[model samples]
Target: MPARVFVALMVTDSGALTAAELAQTLRVSPAAVSGAVRYLTRLHLVIREREPGSRRDIFRVRDEAWQDALANRDALLAQYSGSFAEGVSVVGRETPAGRRLTEAMEFFEFLRKELDGLMDRWRAHRDAPRPDGPPA
Candidate 1:
């Protein structure tokens, strides 16, 4: 359902949809759409906002949604790395559990470090001049 909502929003010209509209488009109940939107919102794949001067909420998928989601993951990676580091410290690095935790910590730390460069490269590719015109 989240996938459906995401695709629906992506293909939508307005890049935004109300819960009732999503339900109608997807042929699902309002409750289903609500659940899906909640999940997507938590994942940073979609944003929810109240319809101005109305009670209905609108969900929008911005041009930078994907980029923002990926960038937000850097903080999660750091958090996981810190957690594993703390676990290792508590268990003693020489213990089997500590060794596992240390490995996990290193992996997350590596990803956090690499994500910066990866995002930069992505921006460069995204911002590179188009064939028909110059860079935006």
Candidate 2:
């Protein structure tokens, strides 16, 4: 499936769509939709849920899913930063490699901080209600 089609399905307000529906909307084959759904599921970006009283599965984005993805990213950055910081220590700060390692670690650290902040904001916005809606 194309990225745009995948995105369209995921971003829908209903939170779920069938492969057939997605294929129709995207003007693509069911095989393409299936492929995209499989890929998205592998990435943990989309979930498949069986509908009640039916075998047909719907693809949906989980609530707090983006927050979880952000957390995973933060974990990766933190791990990389820790390892690179240690490398910087071993290389000696006065050397070019050491300086480069330090810079890389610093960048990852900063990115981790940014991801943390972004996750917080995402949660806040997600939990907040629209002006016309009830309390979140």
Candidate closest to the true structure, highest TM-score? 1
- TM-score to true structure, per model: 0.88, 0.71
Instruction: Give a tens-digit lDDT track for model 2, residues 3-99.
Output: 7655776678897888888988888899988888888776677889998899999888766666676687877898999999899889898799999
RMSD of each: 1.8, 3.1
- Candidate 2 Cα lDDT to native: 0.81
Give the per-residue lDDT of model 1 (tens digit) for 1-136.
8999999999999999999999999999999999998998898889998999999889988568888899999888989999999999899999999999999999999998899999999999889999989876
lDDT of 1: 0.92
Highest-scoring model, lDDT = 1
Clashing pairs in 2: none
How many clashing pairs per prediction, in order?
0, 0
Q: Relative to the unseen true structure, what is the C-alpha lDDT of residue 21 in candidate 2, on a scale of 0 to 100? A: 83
Report the error of model 2 at residue 124, Å. Answer: 4.2
* Residue range with the least summed lDDT across 10 consecutive positions in model 2: 1-10
